[model samples]
Target chain A: MKARVTVTLKTGILDPQGKAIEGALKSLGVAGIASVRQGKVFDIELAGADPAQAEAALKDAADKLLANTVIENYNIEVRS
Target chain B: MKARVTVTLKTGILDPQGKAIEGALKSLGVAGIASVRQGKVFDIELAGADPAQAEAALKDAADKLLANTVIENYNIEVRS
Candidate 1:
């Protein structure tokens, strides 16, 4: 099975890196760019796992390292 | 509008950080976790912006700072 984990920052958190990226975009002549927020995606391959088991494993991954849990949230999707 | 940018390593990239994270998870007694891939996420609120504009802006941000482009890929989602 294959799983993808997406982790993102919650709203109201100040993202200086994102702001810097936004400024760089504007300076590069990329118009209409108001702002930028950056996040993470993780794709993992799990050998010999059932869908339900893989999802549970992915959630465990989220809790452990995929998300900060302090200022971020995570979601998982499993594919055969 | 609000936009979220997700950046991840392309397959075939050796992610040492992800491997370390996976090891940490295993040590912490989080069972069933076979592997882990670490990535980055960003979220931004664009006041008074259209979805299309926000997406284009996000692509520009990706090109500038959100992604390495050499070994990473990025995806964007916009919400009103």
Candidate 2:
């Protein structure tokens, strides 16, 4: 099974890196870009793991280590 | 218009951050895992932009700034 985890900043949180990217894009003349926000993607390969069990484990992993719960939200997707 | 750019390291490139995460997961008792890879995701909002044009611009941005063409590959998705 393969799973993916995406972690993103909460709506109200400030993202300096994203701001920097947006500014860079504008400077580079990539026109019409209004905003840019950055986040993380984690691709995981699991061996001999059931989809449901992997999803549950990944959720736990996200909650415990992959995300800063106070400032970030994480989404997990499992594919067989 | 909204777009997403996902940048990932090339297959042969070394990813210390991902290795560290894998170690941490193992230490934290995350079982049944094979490997872990990490990447970046950017959420972009374009104002009054046509879908095809936005996608092209995004691809340009990814090539010039969002991704290091030598070591990373990026996928751009533009949604209406």
Per-model clash counts, in order, read 10, 0
lDDT of 1 at A29: 74
Residue-by-residue lDDT tens digits, candidate 2, A48-74:
668888987888789989999999999
lDDT of 2 at A76: 93
Give the DockQ of candidate 1.
0.54
DockQ of 2: 0.87
Worst 10 residues of 1 chain B by lDDT: B41-50
Candidate 1 residue-wise lDDT, A51-74, digit = tens: 887787778768866789999877
TM-score of chain A of each: 0.93, 0.95
- Candidate DockQ scores, in order: 0.54, 0.87
Off by over 4 Å in 1: B1-4, B44-57, B76-80
Please, what is the TM-score per model?
Answer: 0.77, 0.96
Give candidate 1's error at residue B7 in angstroms: 2.6
lDDT (tens digit, per residue) of candidate 2 on B30-69? 8876788999999999886688888888988998899999
lDDT of 1 by residue, B1-80 (tens): 77677778888999999898778877877666677788877766665556877677668767876689999988787878
Model 1 docking tier (incorrect/acceptable/medium/high): medium
